[model samples]
Target: MSVRLRLAALGVAAATAAAGLALVTAPAAVALDNGLARTPQMGFNNWNATHCSGDFNETMVKGIADLFVSSGLKAAGYQYVNLDDCWALPARDAGGNLVPDPVRFPDGIKAVADYVHAKGLKFGLYSSAGTKTCNTAGFPGGLGHEKQDAALWASWGVDYLKYDNCNNQGVDAVQRYTAMRDALAATGRPILYSLCEWGQNQPWNWATSVGNSWRTTGDINDTYAKMLSIFKANIKLGQYAGPGHWNDPDMLEVGNGGMTDTEYRSHFSLWSIMASPLLIGSDIRKATPATMAILTNKDVIAVDQDPLGVQGTELSNANGLHVISKPLAGGDRAVALFNENGTPATISTTAAAVGLPKALGYQLNDLWSHKTTETAGKISATVPAHGTAMFRVHAGGAWWSNPPAVHTSADLPLPYPGAPALVQPGTTTTLTTTTTNDGVLPGLLGEVKLTGPAGWTVKATSPTFHPVLPAGRDVSTKWSVSTPADTPPGSYPLHVSTTYYPGKSTSDYDLTVSVAAPLTAGTTGLGDDPWLSADNGYGPVERNTSNGESKAGDGHPITLGGVTYAKGLGVNAPSTITYYPAGHCSAVTATVGLDDEKTGAGSVTFEIWADGNKVADTGLIKRGDPAQSLHADVTGAGLLRLIVTDGGDGNTNDHADWANAQITC
Candidate 1:
């Protein structure tokens, strides 16, 4: 049978088994009605938003859950107040019971659950499939205590459990998580189980039977690359996620630092289109108006929560720039055009590219614009630099009262905003134009028309369309303004126009676009390299840092190089190697350094061996080095050791070293 079919059968068997057990008891017990009522779980997480320092307690949780309801978040389809790491004490009670840190959560889990329940919100906690939980420093390991801990959580009223995998042993991640599934099932509580193994084993196929959602990638930081990387990886797992099970790409970074408003909107829109779990990881208490709009965009959220449950799939991509399309339940489709490029890039997707009819007549609602429009033929929109444009396309005349309203800037273009500057000659450039769209109808699409002087000829044009700009919307399309090779240096006027189509009407802007000298290489500080400023190579996995051991109900005690890193950025590595001193492994060394300096490119490598023979290997990593946060599975028996080295361009001192590594599996 096909792998997909096999996995589906596995899910049926697992669920059926669990159901049978329940029937033998009460006969009425069943999988809790925990399907995400909406597309995205529009809610807040304590980590990115409040951080661990917020000292989230019963009062704090109640307040946040209440805010979710009072502020129309609940009405906007936001649910779940996920409590990230650091809420448990360092040890379990004498009865081997896990206890919340009194100072952080004075009222205990039950009280906090009550408060969240009162606010019409669900509560979620974090754990790991390994011997230690992600918050092991405070809580205990679920490794041997899966059954007890799960039952304990159910007793405390947790409606959702975010099970992460830290200090886990090997590729047996599927089995590790299955243990918890059995445990949680035994508790007789229907909790929304979310697998957080960072996509190590392609959890999409194995986790459906165990969790409501499984993380398809690593933990997400507030940076654009971090978010983009996670999203890009999910393209291959698209077909595996559905209504009850999803491929979580990690929590939303909305309202978090390290990204601009435009970037955050792109983040939200893309996540919505992916049909991934929407657990907000940013603070909600101090959310800005723009952030609020992104968090509660009904149109975008609709795409995520579409009843069709078919996760979005990547259609096309290049140089980090990509396009993903998802079909909606109402015989329509939602398409997200993304430009992950450091410099602006143009991207387009006609209905036909994604298996839809070209003449279906489309409704282009700028997710960021929160408005709608209709197109008879092809509809296109340009993605801005490191930005995204998400649209809800439906059969024209299907969901319209009186063609959607359209408008460009009611205000005229402010006097020519000076001449345009070329950041990359014959490649790309940034152009600015004023419009009166003011976020009305389906925003405006900016376009530039250029004319060359006497001898100078217009070269290939580089276009960047802002996704639902500050007050205007840009149409999605490709630009072609070829420049004459080695053309004479001369001044040129590029005509700029901003077009708008409201409902069934279309408008265009006419203005001057002057060209300036091309920008020198690297002068713009922004170029084609998206990995700029990224770590040059892999580093060592700091033992006790990203690796730990613990028992469920017994707070995890991670001895990081003799110290404890129980807070922010805590310590993460792609993988951790523990030494047990046996078999071929006589000695081990963990080293992280730079590589490819001679070629100006680099990579991170985690090398493992036994008696001079390579035993395990982790490939190149472009994200960061020191081997931090690398996810993989290995094969072998005997001593497990490691050495992390940098293969990317840079200095040798950039390497990280570890003398001993261990494997509990």
Candidate 2:
């Protein structure tokens, strides 16, 4: 049996977690009282930014401590200032004690600890449970010298120990980590014990009393893919995180410059809701406004540090969209609407959907936007690709989980079929939005306004306000929206704002301002003015390129069977794209294969459906082989679907490509 399943045999709670794994908890008699990291330790680690670089010296460490206070990070609960690997020399001293690198820390480890302590910040050091550390420098680890190393760290006033797993020489992971845990306990010091075991041995199943926080995934890089992967790995283990012992999904990559601000905000939101340790991994000294704003989002941080010790659980994960709910201390719910898709889409969940009790009106606080709005009951947002919309939802209050946000959708009976109705330049269309009062109480609906690009005319045709909106009802507000005469032929952003309580509460929705295609029908298939009704995947699918690692990054050319194509769609595995054909097309053709990128490490299957009927399929294509050609008949099909699956294996590098995809009438 897997280690996760074995938790029941180890006197752990037999109840299962949302991930369907056995929820493990240590016996009350054995709960470790390290008196540290009661609510997922918040701090900074130098590994992500410095990584043993020349600049990661005493001066840098001191600068971080100084900035921590001046930058208001300490006030926001970022206390510990920790150092990662490579602080020590490759060899120990004559007495077999680990020696600080003279060039890096001239005054020894204690001096740096003292300096940090002077600033009212705790200090941490890094080591491994094996003979050698993980880095190539091969610094000596504390494998056989657990007690001795623990004493030395305690003597230096080290407040935390991030003990990694490397070069274990085949020792059982539990035994190896437990040895260091006992040693730290023996020191009679209150230093926090962190297990950087990388979840290889299912630390969540057994590390409750062993370490304060254990790494549940591999190292995190400054990329959306890595962050999302780490989140997926750690989100399921929420049942294990509590006051003292928590799950560590590596460290934060906030100011690392690899991802967009939107993605960084999503990362921070996910980490916070999961109750993971909030360790700032970037160099705060060089942090920008965007990075700092994301790092110190106080409302979101409050959710992370909620004294209840309850981690967020996934309410729903469907079609690359996720809704997570974390129960706060005082009956508040921190709801996260996360979109893992490549395109912007609306993600939402009602208060009732998140298990909140019935209330008159729910006040919604947008944690990222920092806007206070009220929802009759619905909670949602137009979450961007790789973005998250966090809301502190409660009935109404000043405590941790208070408020509900609004949920808005386009009214049915659209003028044109399919999503994102195409409209001509300079033309006016009647737009109707459904203003919902899903709350249990009556609501006062005020001015409903629609704002769009400059020069676009958007005026409400119907009454802007319905003084009293009853519970579980919707008000359809119609607006005459007109585009500029010279409007561009691309998707635009339009926001529809509705005030429920005049100046006090409001709700908003981001509407996709779709316009006419620049070219109605090009030689390429998708250029034929076909509207995309649905597209969802693990990662965003790119146009005319192979799938990227994450986000809508510039992907590699569509190469299949060693041939590069100029026109096609690049998609990750488990992807589906439904195209609304503008006119009758006899058939669709394409060369399907795994993209040559990823160094030939992918397995995928491409399938096509016409009018809900499976028309063509390239079953099970692996890497390093020629492309498979596909031709699907769709004589009278109004919709065509392009799908990619992970070939019955987990989607690791499944970058599937549709090469030279075209349609023939």
lDDT top scorer: 2
Model 2 error, position 475 (Å): 2.1
Clashes of 2: 9
Q: Which residue pairs clash within candidate 2?
A: 38-243, 332-401, 363-403, 363-404, 364-404, 376-439, 377-439, 394-402, 394-403
The per-prediction CA RMSD against the true structure, in angstroms, equals 14.7, 5.9
> Per-residue lDDT for 592-611 in model 2, tens only?
88887877467888898875
Best by TM-score: 2
User: Candidate 1: which stretches are off by over 4 Å?
Assistant: 1-42, 135-138, 169-171, 358-360, 398-592, 595-665
TM for candidate 2 is: 0.76
Superposition error at 298 for model 1 (Å): 0.8
